[model samples]
Each structure stands twice: as structure tokens, then as C-alpha cells.
Target: MIRRPVLLRAARPVALTLLVLFGTGTGTIDLWAQPVQKPLTKQAQTELDTIGAELRANARKREQKHQSARQIAEEMERLRTQMIDIARTQGASEKRAAIYRSRLETLTLLEADMTRRLGTLRNKQSRLLSALQIYSRNPPPTIFVSTRKANDAVIAAIILKEITPELKKRAAVLSEQNRDLIRVRREAALQNEALFISESDVSEQQKQLETLMADRAALEDQLLREADAIEARNLELEARQRTLLGLPSPLRAPQGRALDLQLPVVGEKAGSYGESIDGQTNRGLRLKTAPGAQVRSPGNGRVEYAGPLEGYGQVVILDVGGDYRIVMTGLGRVYVDPNRTVAKGEPLGRTPNLTDKPTIFYMELRKGENPVNPASGFDLTKL
Candidate 1:
């Protein structure tokens, strides 16, 4: 009887644990293993079982919905990656188009330059032909023709008097040896024609050579322009890359840095700085003066661009320190060699005639890449 009580006490705790485990996922197995007993009302047990079955179904549905949502999210992520790749491809195409457009512009300029040079060559050839014709027609005026019959007869008589009677009688036999001067002159005219043909052929050949040279020169200029554009593009791309990589911008010289052109005799302001009288915007400040007037360098540095440039006539570009450049234009002739270093107020060359309208000295100053108007930069005290 005591053993029975002890066993019942242990069985009570085991029963509670089985009830807790059944309430979780082991409910079906527990129900099958346990003996059927009418401890609670049959209606209440049936209702509890039905609610557990409904709960299990709802959990399974929720799991399915969660899995579907995860798959959709993964697909959306993949599409977003593809879109980014497409955008990058579009950007690359745009850059290529821009480069091609620049190249086309450069090619157009080259063609125009070549056309101008060819026209110049043709004009030179025409002038040469005219000069050759004038030379051939006015042959030195030194060859004199005598038309005095007395002189001719006297010359013939002298010859007869000097000769013996037998020789004089043989004169008729020698008469057949006399040559025709008209025939000689005709041959000379033919020679002149041959020379003209030769000279014309040479001139044409020279013109052809000049055309070839101009073509090559234009090609070179185009190449240089293209190279510069490419370099600029590369620089821009690099700058963008640096920005993307979170780098600081490169330092450059400040704009409108004051420069000194150590000239001693600063000429007067022959003309006020403004647009041309025609209202066209002037590229630089023009100081009107006579030809052969001394031009002073505006700044001290090595000369960069020193030659005959279009529109500006003769120009000398000086490279001042700190990325400053000074352009002195409208020169009559360049007296200094390129790459020569000069001080401010240094004599450059004589001022050239500005198409006979005015003898002007055009000056401009640049700091770094920005242009500072000469009117604003230079001291106009000496003008």
C-alpha cells in the first residue's frame, strides 16, 4: 500500500509534464499514446483540438508568404544591379560621342586652312607667269639693228678691194655660203618658247610642292589641336575621378595676379582702351603709334609665342612667372629670338601698321588660364 502511494506521487508530476509537451508540437503523439479518459467534458476537448489545428494551418501560411517575399526581394536586387550597368554603358557612349565631335571640328578647320593655302599657291603661280612674259617680250634692248644701205655697200666694196681679181671673180662661188639672219632670229624665238615652257613647268611643279607642304602643315596643326583636346579631356576625366575618390582639388595661381613689365620708358596712352571704332570687340589693348616706334615688354619672362600670327599680325607672347602670360601684338617685325628671356620694359620690336588704319600695339595679360583685360591689369599712367 505504501509503494502504491509513492508511485502515484511520481506519476502525478509525469502527467503534468506530458500535458505541457502535448500543448506544444508533440500533441498528436501524446494523444495517441495516452489512455483515453473522461476527465474533462468531451465538448470542451473537441473544441480545443479544433483550435490547435487552425493555429497550425495559419503558421504554415505565414511561412509560405515570408519565403515568397524573400524571393521577390532578391529578384529586385538583381534588376537594380543590371540598371546600374546600363547607366554606365550609356555614360561611356556619351563620352565617345563628345570625343568624335571634337575630332570632326578639328578636321573641318584643317580642310579650311588647306583650301586657303592652295588658293595662295595659285595666285603665286599666276604672278610668276606674268613676270616671265614681261621678261621675254622686253629683251634687254641692247641688240641694235642697222638699216644704212651705204654702210652695207661700203663694207662690200672694202671686201672686194682687199681681195685679188681672181678671188673677186670667185665671189659668185662663195655667195652660196652666206647664212640667213632671219632664220637665226626665228630659231632664237623658238628657243625662247622652249624656255617659257620649261619655266612654266617649273612654276607649276613649285606650286604643286607648295600645295603638298600646305596640306602637310594643315594636317600637323589639326593633329596638335586634337592632341590638345584629348589632353583637356583626359584632365577633366582625371579631375572627375579625383572628386569621386574624395581628393582635394589641385592648387593653381590666383586670378589677376599683378605682373611687372620692367620697362623704363612707358609710352603715353596713344589711344584709350576700348572696342574698335567699328564696335567689334578688340582682343587686346591697342596703343596707336607710328611704325618703327619702340615696343616694350609688359612683363619679365621667357618669350613663348613670337612670330606672325593671323589677325594679330606679328606678336610676342611672354611667359611671366606664376603662370602669367603677356601678349604684345601688332609688331612690325620680331627682333628677338624665341625662348629668349627678357625683363619688363625690354625692347621687343617696332610697332607695325595696323592695315594703315593705325599703328597700334595690342597688349593682353593672362594669369593661369583666365584672361585679365589689359585695361584692368596694366597701369595706364604711362599709357
Candidate 2:
């Protein structure tokens, strides 16, 4: 009898801790005091089986799309190589050269369109990957629910009666999250595969275009006799080549001082340069702000990098001319793509929504990979 009272006293603290964690009332203590087992009914089993089948089917569909994208990318690469080879061998025939040029022009446009599509897929994949990581770190408890009311009654008597309502709610939320994670994982895998294939396709096309340009330059020197005519034709070809290749003009320094530039995002500085986070010294300033807050470009520049980065959810690196580069990270979504130009104050991306944690945006200025204080260039009062 004395031992019984001692055990009850010891169990009280444990029960109370659980109640605090789960936010359950005193009435829930008795229900959750003992372990219980309940077998799922036939209808409930059938429903879960159906759900599993649907998930598999969706994964297969995504796989098919991935394969299709890969095939198309391969075909694009082959066509580009064929066009370049034809242009080099048949340059003497004006009709053949014209045909090859037209095909090349079409291919260039198609490549750009495909690149944009791939970028979208990459962004989606990044978001899904972030969610997956979060779920993996803090997994929810599992609880089985029955679909048939009669079976549910039996299950409830055996198990549900022994589980707190708060815990049941948590279990349900976790179950839904698991389903979402499965779907997102399959989709992200397909997107990544498609992106890899498209990148290879674009690289090959660019190489072929460069080769064709070189061939044209050589042929011009061999065929043309008049120096003046040859120079003029070469200049025209050079201009056409630059346009077709989408090469940027020579980099020039900005007119105003760097300090006059606007702030990238509207937020208070959380950490300054030289401050250590997780034992690593910060090379830039961390800005704390609301979730989904818009991140903007501090000055006119081109996007150099935009995608998922380790430790950072999504990152965007912008080239602002004169060897100056801006690095922004901890974004939820990116609005720009590499090689795309942006004006000052243009939207670059948004900070991720971390419900239980504060959203922080990290920004750094660099001159050839050497970190510099961004505050030296921006108005401190505004940020």
C-alpha cells in the first residue's frame, strides 16, 4: 500500500510534464496514463492502401515528365551541333549559310525559353527541399484513425480513450504533413533531373555557336581580297555575333558613390560584420524582418547566382559592376535568374516564413570574393 502511493506520486510529475508540452487539461491525464493497442478495421486499412497507391501514381507521372524533358534537351543539343557543322563546311554556298543561320536563330530563342522553365522548376524544388528538412528534424507522432464508425468505436475504446485530445490533434497534423512531404519530394526529384538535362543542352548550344562564329571569322579572311570591304564585313559579323550570343557590354563603374545606393531590404540589422554565428565569423550584416518580406536590389546589376545554397534556404548573388558583387541569402523564393539585369530597388526575392523562428536576411558586399561592409555603402538610417 505504501509502494502504491509512492508510484502514484512519481507518475504525477511525468504526467504533468506531458500535459504542459501537449497543452492538455487535467481530465486528459487519466486517458493518457496507460499504453493501449488497437487494430485498424478493414475499411480504414483499405483507405490507407488507396492513399498509398495514389502517391505512387503521382510519382510515376512526374518521372514521365522528367524523361520527356531529358529527351527534348538531348534533341536540342544534337540539332545545334548539326547546324554548326553544316555552317562550317558549306560557307561558300550563300543559300546554305542562310538556312543554317535561320535554324541557329530559332534554336537560340528556344534555349532561352527552356532555361526560364528550368529556373522555375529549380525554385520549386528548393522550396520543397527546405520543407523536407524541417519535417525530418521535427517529426510528428503517428496515430492511426479508422474510417468505419463501428470499428472507430472499438478503436477509440482501446486506444483513443487512452490518448489525450491535444496529442491526437498533433498526430493528425503530422499525418497531413507526411502526405505533403511525399508529394513534394517526388516532384522535386523530377524538377532536379529536368534542370540537369536542360543545363547540359544550353551549354552545348553555346559551344556550337562560339565555334560557328570562329569559323566565319576564318572564312572572311580567306575569301575577301579588299582590306576595306573585309574590315567592314568583319565588323558587321562581330556585331551580329555579339547580339546572337547575348554577351553583356563591358563593365563600367557606377556614376554615384556606393554609399548613396539604397538598402536591399527594409529591416533592422541583426548582426554586424565580424560577429560569429554558430562559431563562424559573419562576413556581412544580418537583417531581421517579417516573413515573406520583399528583398530588392541595391543597385542596377545582373543576377550571377540564384538557387538553393547549403545552410541558406535560397541565395541570390548580383553583379553591380566594377568588380562589386552583392550576396543575399535566407530567401524563400527568388524572382530573378542568372544573367538577367535588374534596376535599383527591383524585387530580387523574399525572406522565408519561419513560424517558430525569426526571419533573418544576410547581405554581403564583395570585391572579387573579399567581403566588405555593406553599411559603408548604404544609408544606415533607412535600413
Candidate 3:
């Protein structure tokens, strides 16, 4: 006997509850939704579509005939490869993470709001249902068709005309919310499974990735000394020039020229390069980042500068090869010290965990002595 998936097992009760809530199963219309913060690039969107398609394809596989042990092993290898590809590609991976984060955030806000609204709706529904049950004791009156007299028909028509539109609108909103909740819950379940995989019975592929992450996070004593020396030298050079523009490009250039980069952090675009603010022109893109969000290196690079400034919070600069440098600011903490070789997508630090408002993160990509439009510096993909 085949055991149905947990989702399948609980579907009926979920459906029934939703039906009772709205008097019809529902929620797809964004009745009271706020605008979502969209930061994905074209490539990132494409990558997401690909991932979703693949996940769906994988789901379809279960409906087919069961496989042998050999076939299962082969499938596992294929899945491992797929996971690695998704994880390493910062654009798709980070975008997905951002989507998940934002979605959960939005869902939280909506759920809170909906909890109150749903309670009211449920109360209204209860009254309506009670009246419905009482009326069911007799033949329930339809607008005009079921009325016994002309005056009764006119009264019923008048009442329905006043109530029908508002009731229908509320019903539609409830239906859409129900659907959205179901979808969100399903995704949350998948994340729980992802979390479980990390905790126990870890896969070899995941272990290898974890090892790399741990290694990147750990800095040796020697690396720390080198980073400090480099940071000091860069500061001295900047002082001599009396300028902070493109400070990392001239010194300690990386060997290989990276052809691409992911955004250093996920955020809503708060400011952009060349935009004038309070009479001063902005030199880099600024983002309103998620609270306590992990900042990642945009590309494979050496940490040229990672410390704090007077007004700005913690900062990190990366020499991302071929004299191309990335300067990031507004981190709450710097994870990588100076002079350490950091891989693309490696965790650099985190934004301040302030909840009142989002912390602003600033990033600039420069070559030689000038800041270039971030898009011109390299392929800037979504993170």
C-alpha cells in the first residue's frame, strides 16, 4: 500500500475550513495587497521560472512508475547536481532567497491583518449562516421568483440590490486569500523540509557546500594580518590623494578578470548612481535592505577593505579581479576581514537588525580611478 503525501492527507480538511470561512473555497484576488518589492533581473527571473518548472517536473515523476534502487541513485545524483547549480549561481539562488524572505514578510503582515479581518468576516458569516439555517426551516425567499406577493417581492428585491454587490465582493476577497494562504503554507512546508535536510542525515553534496561556507567564514591569523596591512596602505593612499573615490582599484588587483557579479545584497532600490540627493550627486546605488539580511560578496574577490566608517555603518570592499572593485556599506557587522580571498556568494556580513525602518546599503563598482555605472562594470545580476 502506498502512503499518500502529508499534503494530500490534509487537503480535505483544509478545503473544508476554507469553505466555511468564505462560504466558498477561495483567495486569488489581491484585494488589500500592497505592492511587492520586486528586485529580480531578467536573468534571475528566467532562472526562477526554470527552477519552478524543474520542481514541477520532479513532482510529475512521482505519478509515474516506481524506480529501482539503481534508478533512485541516478536520480539523486541528478538532483544533487541541480541543487549545486542553483546554489552556486548567485543570481537565481539569491533571488529565490529574497523572494522567499519578502514573501514570508508580506505573508506575515497579511496574516496579521487578515486575522483581524477574517475574524470579522467569520462573525458576519456566522450570522448569515445562522439566518440561513433558520430560514432553511421554511422555503428560503429568493429575490422575486420565490416571493408569494408583489410587495414581498419588491422588498426582497430592494434588500438584495443593496446587499448583493458588497457580499459578493467580500466573498471574492475571502476566496482569493484562501488560495494564497494554501500556496504560502505549501512553500513553508518545503522550507521546513529544507531545514531538516541541513540538521540531520546531511547529503554529501550539501556537506561539501557547507564545508566551503565554513572555510570562507573562518579567517586564519596570517590572513587577518595581511588584510590589516592592506587596509592601512589603502587608507594611506586615499589620504595622500585626499579622495576616497576608487581607492581599491590601483592596489592589490586580483589575477583573473571576473565577467559577472551578483548584487551584494537583496533590497528595494532606495537610491541610484548619478542621482542628485540634497545637491550632492550619488556615486553608487543604495538599497533599503531587509533587517538582519545576510550580505554576500558580489563576485569571487579578495577583501580589500572591511571595517567601519564614521557616519556609515560597517563596510566591506572587494577587489573582484581585473582592477574591478566593489564597495559596500551599511553592514551591521563585517564577517570577512581584509586580505581574505572570498568566493562569489560568500556571506560578507549583515544589515543592522533595526525593525523600525530598513537599513540602507550602498554599493559602487569602480575601475582605476573612476566609478562606472554598475551595469557597465560587469554583468550585475540579482542577489
Pick by lDDT: which candidate is best?
A: 3
lDDT score at residue 113, model 1, on the 0-100 scale: 60
- In model 3, what lDDT does residue 227 have? 32
Worst 10 residues of 2 by lDDT: 1-10
Tell me how far candidate 1 lies from the true structure as C-alpha RMSD in angstroms: 35.9
Clashes (backbone N, CA, C under 3 Å), per candidate, total 8, 1, 6
Arranged by lDDT, best first: 3, 2, 1
TM-score of 2: 0.33
Name the Cα RMSD for model 2. Answer: 45.4
lDDT of 2 by residue, 1-383 (tens): 00111122223332333432444443332322322223334554454344334434443453343344334334445555777675564434444445545555554565555556555655665565566467557544334433565464566445634544644565565555555555555555554455455445545655776676456433332222132233334334334322332334323434445645677765777888888989999999888865445678999999999999898779999998888898889886687888999999887876653242447888898878899876666555433
Instruction: Compose the digit string of candidate 3's lDDT tens values, residues 1-383.
Output: 01222222122332322322343223322110212233344554454344334433433343221122223324444555666674566455445556666666665667667667777887896787577456446543555444356566567558757876887788888788777767766776675554444433335556665555445334222233343343344334324322211112223323333456777776767777899988999988888865545688888989988999787768898998788888888886688889999998888986664342567889888886678788665443332
The digit string of per-residue lDDT tens for model 1 on 1-383 reads: 00111111112222333453343343332222343343433554454344344434443443343344334334444544555565556565555555555554554565456555545655655565466457556544333535565465456457545744644444433332222223434454554455455445545654654565455434433433343343344345435433332345655433453554433122444434456657665655656553334566766789897889888788888888888787777676576788999876676765532232335566767777666766445555434
Pairs of residues clashing in candidate 1:
261-298, 261-344, 262-344, 262-345, 263-344, 263-345, 268-383, 332-352
Question: lDDT of each structure?
Answer: 0.50, 0.57, 0.58
